[model samples]
Target: MSNNVPTGAEFKEQLRAGAPKMGLFLNSHSPTVAEQLAHSGYDWLLVDTQHGPMDHEKLSNMLCAIASGGAKSMVRVAGYHDRGGIQQALDLGADGVLVPYINTAEEARQAVSCTRYPTAGTRSVYFPQRSMNKAGLLGYAGNANKNVIVALQVETAACIENMAEIAAVPGVDMLFLGQNDLCMSMGLYEKYEFPHMYTSPELQAATETLISEARKNNVILGLFLFGTTRVAEFLAKGFSFISVGNDLHHVLTQSAAYVQDLEKIAATEGKLWTRRPTALF
Candidate 1:
C-alpha cells in the first residue's frame, strides 16, 4: 500500500522564502535515469513530456521512480490546453505541473482548473491510482488543488504583455521563462554565454517585467540556467526557481569537456595516456 502523493509544501516554502530551488529536466524518459537523479540532491525534477518522448505510461513510471528521490516531480504536459495530460499527471502524483505557452489569464485559469476536481476545476476523478496510496483518495482531493504547484511559462510576447494578468491568476504558483525560446522570440538568435545571455536588453527587459509583476502579486519567478555560474545573479534579482540542465545534457557536457581536455594534454605530451586522467565527474 505504498502511495505516492505530491505535497507542494516545499515548493511553496521556497517560493515564499525567496530561496532558490534548482530543478532538473528529466528528458531521458528512462526510469533508471529518473531513479539516479532522485539521489542527485536536486530540489525538483521535471519530466519533459512536451518536447521529450514521455507518453502517459512512461511519465507515470517516471513519477514513481522520481518519488524516492529528494527532488519533487513535475510534468511539462504536451500542449498548453491539454486537460488529458494535466489530469493524468496529477492523478499519477506529480508535485506540480509546468504548462507551456501561457499567453493570457484565461489559459492560466484553465490550466489550474484542469488540476482540480468538479466544484473547483474540470479535473475528472478516476482515483485509486498510484497517487492515492489506495487509501488517501478522499483526503487527497481535499487539499490537492491548493497544494499542487502550477507553474506557467511566460514565453511569448503576448505572455509578457499580459504578465500582470497571468500573475493574478489564483492557482498559478510560479512563472518561468525558457531563455532560449524567449531569445528566439525577440529575434536575438546569437549564441551568448551562460549568465551573459540574460544580460541582453530584450532578456533583461523581460526579467524586469516579470520581477515587477511578481513583486506586485507575490508570485515566484523562474529562469532556465546552464549551471551554478549565474545563480547568485538571478537569485539577487528575486528568482526562486531554476532548472540546471537535463540529465543527458549534464552527462554529455561534462564527459565531452573531459575528453577534450585529455586530448589537449595528450597533444602537448605526445602521448595519449602519459598521465592519469582528471576526474571531472
Candidate 2:
C-alpha cells in the first residue's frame, strides 16, 4: 500500500466532515474481484461474512487484496454478538467492522469493545499478526482503539426505538440503516410493494428519526441503498456512508442483460436457437 493512501482514521474523519463515501459490498469471495473493485475507485470495500461463503482464510486473503489497491477494508461479522469473529477480522487487518442486529446501546457498546484492547475495551492481542505487520506492533496496539471503526446496523423496530441511545453510545462511529430488514421488522415489507418500500410513510419516518439522532450525536449516517438509483436522493437526505450494491448482483445483472441482448439480435437475424438444459456439473 502507498504511504499516501488515507488511513482508516482519516476515513472516519472524512465521514465526520460530512463527506459522502461510496462503497461496494463484496460477496463473491474472489480476491481477484475484490482487488479489481478496490482499484476501481470505491472509497471502501466490505467483505460480507454474514451471508457470504468466506471462511477465515478467505477473509484474510480478501483483506490483503483490498489493501493492495489502497481502499479501506471492513468485515461484516456473522452476528452482533460474535466477539471472536470481530477479533479475527481486525487481527486479519480489516480497517473496521460492520456489526448486524445491534438493537440496543449495550449491544453497540459490546461491538465497539470488541475492536479495542484492554483499559479501553477487552479485545485480545496477538503479536506479529497481519494488523501488526501493516501498522507496526506498537503503533497498531496503541492506536487501533482510535482508528478501528465500529459501525452498527439498525434494522429492527427495537433498534429504531433505541436509536438515540444507540447513536450516543461511546465509540460508535457510524450507524447503518439496513433497509430491507428494517422494512421487514416494521411490517412494511408485506404491506408495500418493492417501489413503495422506500417511500412508505412508516419507513420514511423511521429514516428521518435515524438521521436526526445521528446528527445530534455527531455520528456518521450510513445506509445499504442496494443500488445507485436512490443514492442521490438519500445523500441529500443526510446519509454519508452508503453502499451502492454488491459484487454478485452486478455480475449477475450485467451478464444476464448481455445474454438477453445477444438473444434478441439472434432472433432478429433468424439465427436464434431453442433453449436446452445443461448438466449441473
Candidate 3:
C-alpha cells in the first residue's frame, strides 16, 4: 500500500479552491473497464457497491485497475453498518469512501469514524490483505488519519432538515447531494424535465444553508447531477465537487438513441423491419 502518492484529501483541498472536482461512478466489475474510465479525464472514480455485485476480491482487483490510469479511486459502501465493505474498501486502497442514504448527523458521525484509524476512529487494519504492495498499505495507514475522504450523501427530506448538524460533523469532507433520490423524497419522482431540483427555491435555500454551515466548519460542498449540463448550475451555486454520470446510463442512453435513429432511417428508406442478433448479459 506504500505507493507514496498524494491522497485525495490533499487533492480535495486544492480542488475546493475554485478548481472543479469531477468524478465518475463504476457500475461494472471489469478491471479493464475501470481503467478505461480512469483514463477518461475523470479526476476520481468510485466503485458502486451499493448496487453492484462487487466482492472484496473483485473490488481489490478493480482498485488496482483504477489506479493503473492514475485516477483517484473511491468506493461507495452499502451503508454505515456495512463495516465489512467499508473496511475492505479502505484497505483495498480507495482514496475515499461515499456512504449513501445518510439522513442523520449520527449516521454521518458513524460513517466518518469507520474510515479512520483506531485512536481517531475504529477501522480494522491488516496489511497485504488487499493493497498488494505493503508499501502502499503502510503509506495508506500512516496518512489514513489525515488522508481518508469521507463524503456523506445528503438526499432525504429529513437530511435536508438536519443539514446543519451533518455538515458540522468534524471529519466529514463533503456533503454530497443525491438529487435523483432527493427529488423522489421531495415528491417529484422522475421530474428532471421540469424545474431543476437544485434550482428550486426550497431546495436551493436548504442547499445554501448547508454550504454556508459546511464552509464555516471547514467542510466542502458537493453535488451529483444526472445531467452534464447541470454542472454549470452547481458550479454557479458554488459547488466544487461533482459526479455527472455512470457507465450503465451512458451506455444505455447512447444505444437507445442510436437504435431510434436507425429505426427512423430504415422507415424512411422503405425497409419494413430491422434484424439483429440479441445478446443478453
Candidate 4:
C-alpha cells in the first residue's frame, strides 16, 4: 500500500470527520481506465459490479489498478444478500463494499455480517486471500472488522420509512442514496420527467427524512450525483461521500461534444452531413 493511500479504517474516519470525499464510479471494467480515474484526484473509486460487467478476476485486477494510483477502492457488490460477492471483494483488497437495496435493519445487519469474520460476524476466512496477503494472516484477521467499510444503499420507500432503524445498525458506516431508484420507488419517475422527477416534492421529503435520520444516528451520508453539477449543492446539504459521475457517462458526453464541434467546423467550410442520434448509455 502507498503511504498516500489511506487504509479502509482511515477512509471511514475521514467520512465520519465530515470531509467531502469525492469519487467516481468505475463501470468500464477496464483496469487501465480505473487506474487513470484513480489518479485523477478523486478520494476514492467505486468498482460498480451491480450494473457493470465485471467478473471476480476482473474485479480483483481493477482493485489492484486503483490501488496502484494511491486511491482507496470500493466495490459495489451485485446484491445486498450476496455474502460471497462481499467476501470476494474484501478478500481481493478492496477497501470497502457497497451493498445495495437494504430495506430493513435485519437486511442491514446481514450486509454488515458478511463483511466481518467469526465472532464479529459470519464472514468465512481464507488464509491465502489477497487481504491476508496484504496485511498478513494475523494482521488481516485482527483488523478486518474495523478496517472494512459497510455502506448500504437506501433507494426504496421501505428503506426511507425504516431509516431510523437502518441507520442505527451497529456496523453500518454509511447510507448511500441511489437517486434514480429512489425516484422510481417514490413514483416520481413515472409521474414526472427526467430532471423534473429529481426535484419532486415527494422525493425532496424523502431526502430530508434520510438526512435527518442519518444525522440523528451519527452515520455518514453518501450520494450518487449524475454529474459534477450538483456537487456543491449536495455537499452543502451534508453529503460527504459523493460520486460525481461514472466512466461511461464521461466518455459519451465528451465524445458527443467533440463530434458536435467537428460538425460546426464542417458547416462553416460549406460541408454538410446527416447527424446520427446520440445515445446516453
**Each prediction's TM-score versus the true structure:** 0.89, 0.94, 0.86, 0.95
> Which of the two, 1 or 4, has more TM-score?
4
Q: Which portions of model 3 show Cα errors greater than 4 Å?
A: 1-6, 130-138, 190-199, 260-281
Question: If the candidates were sorted by their TM-score against the true structure, best first, what order would they fall in?
Answer: 4, 2, 1, 3
**Per-residue lDDT of candidate 3, residues 1-281 (tens digit):** 23544566567676567678788788887788898888888888889999888888899999999988888888999997778888888878788899999888899889988988888888888867654364466775777777788888877888888888888887888888887678778766555457665567666676777778777877777877765887887888778888887777667767867877887898999986553555621
| Candidate 1 least-lDDT 10 residues | 1-10
Error of 3 at 95 (Å): 0.7
- lDDT tens digits by residue: candidate 1, 1-281: 12332357655866768877788998887999998898888878999999898789888889988987756888998656898899889889888889998888998898888887778888887758777773488877877777788889878877888898999988778888787777767666665655465678878898789889978888888877777787888889988888888888898788777877887888898886533454644
Worst 10 residues of 2 by lDDT: 272-281
**Residue 274, model 4, lDDT:** 44
Off by over 4 Å in 4: none
Model 2 deviation from native, Cα RMSD in Å: 2.7
Please give the lDDT score at residue 211 for candidate 3: 75
Best by TM-score: 4
- What's the lDDT for candidate 4? 0.89
Error of 4 at 268 (Å): 3.1
In order, the Cα lDDT scores of the candidates are: 0.81, 0.89, 0.79, 0.89
User: What's the TM for model 4?
Assistant: 0.95
Candidate 1, which segments miss by more than 4 Å at Cα? 1-6, 190-197, 272-281
Per-residue lDDT tens digits for candidate 2, residues 5-24, read: 77778889888897988899
- When summed lDDT is taken over every stretch of 10 residues in candidate 4, the lowest stretch is 272-281
Error of 4 at 10 (Å): 1.5
